[model samples]
Target: MSDTITLLYAQSVIWLVVFGLCAVIALMFRRVRAFYRRIAPLGALAPTAATIAHLPTTFLRSFSGSEVTAGGSREDGRPQLLVFVSGSCPVSRKMVPIVDDFARRERLSLLYCGDESDEAQKRTIATLGLSESGFVNDAAIGRLLGVDRVPFAVLLDPTGTVQARGLVNNLEHLESLLGVQETGYRSLQGFMTANPRALTG
Candidate 1:
């Protein structure tokens, strides 16, 4: 009788451990499935150049006053070009001159949104001649724009939909989205890099 009881106890302990391990594995599988589901939307999207030309309407709210640029003018119109920069990002510096020139020429409506309290940021904007451009203080615009990193630019229609987006560090991705034949645009790589950031929390 004593031997039987010990065997029963040992069996119970073994079963419990097995069950716990199964539960942990199941939980991990569920988390991975959820991550895949979020990004699946992008996979289903056929990122053709023609489809990319039309700007999609953005779902975020617009800024109303001095807090943002063009009196929130960029927000009210169709998807316009939006760029995000940080006071410390070197890549942003490389693109600022291009952005300022693009905006000044009115080739596209550009909005430069960045961290507000840094005095150097003010100087950076002034130096770039974007002081009167549609400057916004909102970080959400960047997130909403699906920007996961700095030195990024997006061509938005007046509706706020992202027509095209990429590292514009070379403007190749930008040109591709616009359907222009640029010598060095890598649309695939840009989309691949930005897709992960767009779907993740």
Candidate 2:
């Protein structure tokens, strides 16, 4: 009887250990699931207020009467970067030098889009030290590009597909568009969410 009780007690202990291990495993799974939920990819990059990505953009002509296509066939086959700005906007003025440098470094076909008067636009171009050839005088172009704010930027692929578009007030914001293009992520948030391990590991 004592042996029987000992055997039963040992069985009970084994079962208890098994249950405890199962509970521990379950808790670990729950924690892992919670972590994944916290880092889940977001759709914030696909904002309703902005133009959709991967869509062909409309073409526009520069003030110089040269065809400045955004997302269509061009003889150069180079990617285009369009920056919408206003001559009177202080933020736009501040970004001019940065945009100019970026364009030169990236070898992108840069175009400055603004609704300012011809003289004001010319002055802004000269002050910014950008090529007059890169200035497109059409406010309607902004509407077509779905730009609602000044200092907005759009990066188009060689095929004229909108690769990235956002409000760029500083160098980081502008560079993030290139990051999105190269990483195949829509936004910085999307990148962090998809690669949570990159942050922790």
Candidate 3:
């Protein structure tokens, strides 16, 4: 009878250990899922209704007669970086310095397009220390680029292909657009989805 009880107790202990191990495994999975969700780069604002990626963009000249080509042969042979901003948008104002620094550092062909009047566009250009030649007063370019939000950016490759485009609220967000292009992902979320192991590693 003692031997029987010992055997039963050992079996019970084994079962308990099995259940505990299962619970631990489940907890680990939950933690991993949470980690992925935390590290996944997602934007608060959605993209414009029109899809801009991989599409040819149209060009319009700035108010100062400087050629603003979005997707075409570049005279300078440098990639173009088009940014949409408004005079009334505080976010756009905040991004001016950041954009200016990026433009100078990257040597990108930068164009600041907006729906604001020519005066307002000029004022913004002056405030940002960007040349008037780089400021476009037309809203049509923004519409064609699917930029419904202020402080939006679209990076075009040298061959005039849309490399990346998105609403940018900060420098990190702006860099993520370039990251999307480098990774060949439509967005940061797409990158994370395809490479979940990246986060864990």
* lDDT (10s digit) by residue, model 3, range 67-160: 6566776778887888888767788889988988887787887878778777777777766565667777776667767888888888887777
Over 1-201, each residue of candidate 1 has an lDDT whose tens digit, in order, gives 999999999999999999999999999999999878876232112232323333344333222244333212354453356776765776777777766666555467667776455466666566555554356555555555556666677665455444556656654434454652131233444555655575565
Model 1 weakest 10-residue run by lDDT: 42-51
Error of 3 at 31 (Å): 10
TM-score, every prediction: 0.47, 0.62, 0.67
Off by over 4 Å in 3: 1-38, 43-46, 51-59, 119-123, 126-130, 189-201
Q: TM-score: which candidate is best?
A: 3
After superposing candidate 1, which stretches have Cα over 4 Å from the reference?
A: 1-79, 103-106, 115-120, 123-129, 180-201
lDDT of 1 at 192: 52
In Å, residue 155's CA in model 1 sits off its true spot by 1.1
CA lDDT for candidate 2: 0.74
The number of clashing residue pairs in each candidate reads 12, 1, 0
Model 2, span 116-164: residue lDDT tens: 7888878777766656667787876666667777778888888777777
